[model samples]
Target: MATTNFDCIVVGSGNAGSCAALAAKDSGCSRVLILDKCPPDWVGGNGYFTAGAHRTVHGGLADLLPIVRNVSPGSDLASTIDMDPYTAEDFTGDIMRLGGGRSDPGLVKTLVENSRDAVQWLHDRVRTPFTFSFNRQAYLVDGRQKFWGGMVLSTDNGGKGVIDAHQKALNEAGVEIWFDTPAIEFILEEEAIVGVVARRDGQAVRLAAPAVVLASGGYESSREMRGKYLGPGWERAKVRGTPYNTGDGLALARSVGAKLTGDFAGCHSTCWDFDAAADTGDRLLSNQYTKSGYPLGLMVNSNGLRFVDEGEDFRNYTYAKFGREIMNQPGGCAWQVWDSKTTSWLRDEEYGDGVVRKVWANTLEELAETLAEDGLQDKAQFLDTIHTYNLAVDAFVQQHPTTKWDPAVKDDLSTHSLPLPKSNWALPITSPPFLAVKVTCGITFTFGGLAIDPDTAGVLSEETGKPITGLFCTGELVGGLFYGNYPGGSGLTAGAVFGIKAGREAAKLARRL
Candidate 1:
């Protein structure tokens, strides 16, 4: 009913969309507009629930010191410790390795090469605060702090901080953001993108723009889409973010001949609290529902059988794929069992607020009985599995007497001769007071989305194998970067890199148009 005009239109107000709008404005676009389907209060999309962990390429803390503000005294401590530099080669190798060699080489190259610059842009240009990931990465080693895992930086206050900084940047840049406005379809003139038709205040509003960037997130919140793409039991999976991402971006782009790529059946899913709310995850305690320490202990299905090799890789590499494994388990649930030896090392979210479906007992048998009361049917099988696992751990420890355990690195401690052998961080469960936490699937975002040009982030046409003019996409809506699994913290970095690319390129193209 109403018509609005802008130089660039960005869909979604999450990290990518906000960054796209900012980049558009900064790149000489006079009028850049951002539209979010969610209301004002619930804007920012899925990034609002993230920890703001960014997987970036940097040459030690020196490359980061100038950009990161209000940072802890790390350079002084680094004299004794060696902070290894993560290079583009290392970043690309990790992505390809973690994604099972299925990742698009072009997208991987873009992500690795521009990751540090993207983060630096946020710090210098967007005014986003940065801090070291001391909690997840740093650990005392030989009286010095050692940081591993290739993920060393995060937003000052995690996702909330990133969103707030982006919002502030957008406001200062004079970019217009419209909440409760969902882009329903793209406007094309003879197959060239022009604008969008968005539903605003229950009315179809026409927003005319020469360039449009779609950054709305994936279909994680859509049960119907999940059931369709991710298979039958995925409908029961808990959404780990906003309820706004319901495959609309994917559906809209596909309607106009965009090529869908990546693993449609895969997503960045993880083990969340079984009883987590059906519609959304808690922003305050977002990661609490995420069971990431399964590698340090063990996970058993309802049938009391160990179904997966928990220590196959770091949590970052394997967590995304494990949720699907949990879904396939009996009853679509699993128990993350931990003994007192390793229980204390768990992060605050593991036992903090909103942990309701956990049970503690003085003995393994008692724990099994408690599990029985909570719907675990096979008590004997559970005890037997634990017994076999403990024996394996004891045998391994006896061979390697002086075990060096470090949570930051994959240790030499491993279990052999088990059906699902733990490849690292294996320890005996002899310590009393074992605990178990029930977990179900928490779907973050679907990996399947429209294919895009690697350099420009322009959506590609499947038929022509050419970039769609004036049409760009980023964030979870851009496919081929991730496959069956993803390295943790890479999602945000990719979003920022590609968002900036999409915005700058779209602005340049729009100016010409």
Candidate 2:
């Protein structure tokens, strides 16, 4: 075995790990090394395959002015012209509400309070480019687009943009990044993590460092771990990002007495195109794998039954967990059906040639037949479901007197009586050329991981109920921020926020030790 040494060792090369390494260097750590299991071809981990949206606290356009560039002075700039502002209080409230108050208090507060600062640092220090993502976060309102929810800004070119910026920053900082190197285990000295045994070039090597930051992400890519932690049938869920996030950080930390926390059986999942390859992470097709237009219309299983509330709230509130609902269906699959009235409102992912698996037809009967040909056994039930929903829409409109359904706000249009109901955006399928897209569960990242102190980003030991001396963690590896559900775009924010904290704190610790 070979041995190497560094002041700080950061595992993973995603947004979080890179941010950690950069911060460590900025904090005066002379030697910082980042170990990534992926080769140069697949370096960014899950962050490489994201839209790179970050939910952070901002006063309004004034605060976002520096972060987002190229804002044309017109309402036609997609949906960000009239975007709403979000304060730290708003972000904290969202975390609590979305996580059902189960999120760790300290961790949530750290995320919200430091989000604005972390985002600012990214723009100012890392020089990451950002812009408003109207298609994902905004809705059309009275011909002028409006951004709803707290998340509106994303990397200029999506996840690839973010990774590119981080890699550039790391290079300028002179941080050593070891691609294709995986941290196999931690070297614990008297219960404190001091170094790591890593596998580089197919050989076990020792890397000695006073402090180690683990941002290697979760167990979403491991079929065995998903089956064990996320429960049965999760093995069928499509991997949304890097196949290397196989709980390496979590497993290594837990081996050294770190406590496991967050929703072990839950994860950030979404409606994915069923035709997508099983484990390949295509940077070009990053955003195309998801099918989020289900709120605009209806989703039916093979039995032609609506199982969950399509319009429970906004897509951000429901989209993450809906993939599990699809997986729970009879065949672990569902189809999102939309009429001509709502089809135009869909994002481009649905219509892309190889992006999604879709079926088009002139009428509901034809749509049903097409779905049947695509493996839906109950064609009659499918047609009847559409007819029943349409009739309900007609009755609701006649009695409620809807003038014009505003796309920006949740409309009053709803079903009068149904076993499972659509709570908002209830548009009837009355127009020709209806569309249905086949979808399955797309698991993004596992929610359960190592428990850490929010203030210091230090991993906590379950046995002692105290922080481990030199082990710090961030990214998806740090648990307690999310439980059963999560607000979309908060993951990246949390990762950067804590990663920066971990790096800074670890650097300080290294200097002291």
Model 1 misplaced regions, further than 4 Å: 69-82, 353-357
Worst 10 residues of 2 by lDDT: 72-81
**Predicted structure 1: lDDT:** 0.86
Residue ranges of candidate 2 with Cα displaced over 4 Å: 72-80
Candidate 1 TM-score to native = 0.96
C-alpha TM-score for every candidate: 0.96, 0.97
